[model samples]
Target: MVQQRTADRDGTQQKANHTPWLEWVASGIGLLLTLGIFGSIGWQAFDDAGAPPAIAVDVTRVVPVEGGYRVEFRARNSTGSTASQVEIEGKLAGDGAEAEIGHVVFDYIPGHSERKGGMFFTREPRQESLALRALGFADP
Candidate 1:
C-alpha cells in the first residue's frame, strides 16, 4: 500500500494559525473602553457640589411695608454639613435703573438656621419692570 503526505518545510510539520479571534475581540473591547472613559468624564463635569448639599434658601415674602419693600429669606442647613457661604442679590426693576443691591453673605453650621434681614429698598420699584420682578422672586 502507498501513503500520502502533506507539504512541509525542512521535512517538518506546519504550524496552525494563532490568535485568529484576537483581532476582532480586541477591537470590540477597545471601542467599549473608549466609550466608558468619555462617559465618566462627562458625568463628572455635569455633577454639582452645592446642589445636593445640606443647605437651602427659602424666600418667604416681598411686601410693600415699612416705607419700602421688606424681603425676608430663610437659610436652612440640615444635611449634616454646614454651608461655608451663602449669597443673596437683588435689584430694582424700572426703566434706566440706578439702584442695584449687592449680595448678602452668611455662614451656618449643621442643624442650625438663620434668617436674612435688612433687604430694604429706598423707594418702591416699578411693578412692571423685569428687574423688579426678579427682585420680587415672582418669576422663579
Candidate 2:
C-alpha cells in the first residue's frame, strides 16, 4: 500500500511510498497458522510418548507355494506408542509331524494401526495348532 504519492514538477509521478498493511496481515496469518499446526503436533506427541506399544500378531491366511507355504499375517499395535523391528513368530504342528517354526519381521507398526506381512514354512499350518504371536519389538 502506498502511504504517500507525490507528483513531480513536470506533472509526472516522482515519489512513491509502500506501507506494510498487507505484509503485516500476511505475517500474522502465517504465524497463527504455524502455531496451530505445531501446537497440535506437540500436544499429540506429549500425550502419546509416555505410553508403550501393545502389539499382537495373528495368522490371516496360509497358502501352499511351490517350495513351501506362504503364511500371511497381520500385526496390530493397539497402544499409543509405535513399535519398530517387530518380530512375529509362527509355529505349525500337525499330528505325528515335527513342529515347523517360521518368523517374519515387520518394519514398523504405528499406534492403533495394523501391518501385513508373510512368512514361509515347509509345512502347511492348520488352524488348530497354528500359533501366531508377537515375539518382540523395539521402541520407536
Candidate 3:
C-alpha cells in the first residue's frame, strides 16, 4: 500500500510540472499576440505621419432659398492628420464683377474623410460664375 501511494504522488507531481509548462506557453503566446498588434498599429501611424493635409472644396449644388441661395458643397480631406477650423470662401462673379461673397466654416474635418456644408448668398449663383476656394485650415 505504501508503494502504491508513492506512485500516485509521483504522478501528481508530474502533472503539476506539466500544467505550469502549458500555462507558460499560453501566456507567452498571448503576450506575443498583444505585442504584434500594437507594433502593427505603431508602424501604420508612423507610415502615415509624413502625409500632408490636403483640403479640397467642391460645389455640389446651388438652390435658391427663402432668404438667399443655398450653396451646397463638399469638403474633402486627403491627409493623414485632422484639420480644424476649416474655412471655405465662395464668390459669385458676373461680367468681370463680383456680385456676392459667401463663406462657410467647418469645426472639424478628419483625415481621409469628407464633410458637407452650405453658404447663403443673396444673388442667384447659377447665373453667375461661382468660384469656391478653401480659405485656410488649422491642425487638430
Candidate 4:
C-alpha cells in the first residue's frame, strides 16, 4: 500500500512539471497576428495623411431644372491632402458676351477621391458656351 501511494505521488509530480509548449506557441502566433493587423491599419492611415493636394474640376452636364439650370460637375482630388470649402465657378457666354455666372461650394473633399456637385444659373446654360473653373480650396 505504501509503494502504491509513492507511485501515485510521483505521477502527480510529473504531470505538474509538464511544459505547455502548444499553448505558448499558440499565444505567440496570436500576438503576432494582432500586431500585423494593427500595423497595416496604422500604415494606411499614415499614407493617406501625408498625401499632397491636387484638385481637378470637370463640367459633366448642364440641364435646366425647375427654377434654373443645374450644372452637373465632378471634382477630383489627386493630392494627398484634404480640401475644405472648395469653390467652383461657372461662366456662361453667348455672342462673345458673359451671359451669366454661377458658383458652388463643397464642404469637404478628401485626397484621392471625387465628389459631385452642381451650380444653378438663371440662364439657359446649355445654349451658351460653358466655362468651368476651380476657384480655390482651403485646407481641411
Candidate 5:
C-alpha cells in the first residue's frame, strides 16, 4: 500500500489522496483509437465502393491429364474490387474444326491479387488457338 502523508500545523500526520491521472490518459487514447479505426473503415468502404472488378484470365500452362488436357489459368484482379464466383472460359479453335470449350469457376479473386484454376479439354491446347477469358464475376 502506498500512502502519502503530510504533517499539519498542529503536528498531526494525515493521509492525502494520491491518485495518478492514468485513467484519463488511457481513456483518451482508447477513444482516439476507436475513432481512427472507424474513420479508416469508412474511408475504405467509400473509396472502392464503385470501383469495378477488372478481372482478367490468362492461360499459364497446359498439361495432359488422365481423361483429357488440363489448362491452368491465372485470374488477376487488377482493380481495387474483390471478385467472387469468377467464371473463366477457355476455347480452342483450329483447322476448320469445331471449337472446344472448357470452363472453371473460382471462389474468390481478391483485389489486386491473383487466383489459379484449371479446366479440362479434350483437344490439345498448344496446337490450337487458345483463348482465355473471364466470363463474369460476382461482387464480394
Candidate 6:
C-alpha cells in the first residue's frame, strides 16, 4: 500500500511539472496586442493635431456694370496651406431678397493670390447697383 501511495504522489508531481506554459505565453502576447492597439490610436490623434484646418474665403467686391455685374474676389487659407478646386458663390441682395446669382472656380495657392475676370451678369433694364453677397472657399 505504501508503494502504491508513493507511485500516485509521483504521478501527481509529473502532471504538475507538465502544466501548460503556453497559457502564460498567450497572456503576455495579449498584453502586447492591447498596448499596440492603444499606441496606434494615440499616434493617429497626434497626427491629426498637426493637420491644417479648413479653408477660409473672402469677397472683395461685386459691382454692377453695363451688361453684367463684375465680381472681384479673394480666398485665403487660414490653416496656412494651399487650397485648390475652390467654389465661390456670389449673391445679389436687392428687391427685399438675397439670391445666389453666380458661381466661379479657381485655385488659391497658399499665402498667395488668384485673380479672375470675365465675371458677367445680365440685369433688367433700368436697374441700379445690385446688392451683392459673396462667399468663397476651397471645396469641403
Best candidate according to TM-score: 2
Worst 10 residues of 1 by lDDT: 131-140
lDDT of 2 by residue, 29-104 (tens): 9999999999987987887766888888877888999998899989999887889999888888878878888878
Runs of candidate 3 exceeding 4 Å displacement: 1-44
Q: Of the candidates shown, which would achieve the greatest lDDT relative to the real structure? A: 3
Pick the winner on TM-score between candidates 3 and 5.
3
Per TM-score, what order, best first? 2, 3, 5, 4, 6, 1
lDDT by residue (1-140, candidate 1, tens digit) is 12334344324433444445887799989999999999976765564422433545555666788667666656665443245545556565545657646355554333344545436776664444313111211101
Off by over 4 Å in 2: 1-5, 8-36
Clashes of each: 1, 0, 0, 2, 0, 2
lDDT of 1 at 87: 53
lDDT against the true structure, per candidate, is: 0.52, 0.83, 0.85, 0.83, 0.82, 0.56
How many residue pairs in model 6 have overlapping backbones?
Answer: 2
Reference-based lDDT, residue 70, model 1 = 68
TM-score of 1: 0.38
TM-score of each: 0.38, 0.69, 0.65, 0.62, 0.63, 0.40
The lowest-lDDT stretch of 10 consecutive residues in candidate 5 is 1-10
State, as a TM-score between 0 and 1, how close model 5 is to the true structure.
Answer: 0.63
* Residue pairs with backbone atoms closer than 3 Å in model 5 (clashes): none
Off by over 4 Å in 4: 1-42, 45-51, 126-128
Model 1, position 8: C-alpha lDDT score: 48
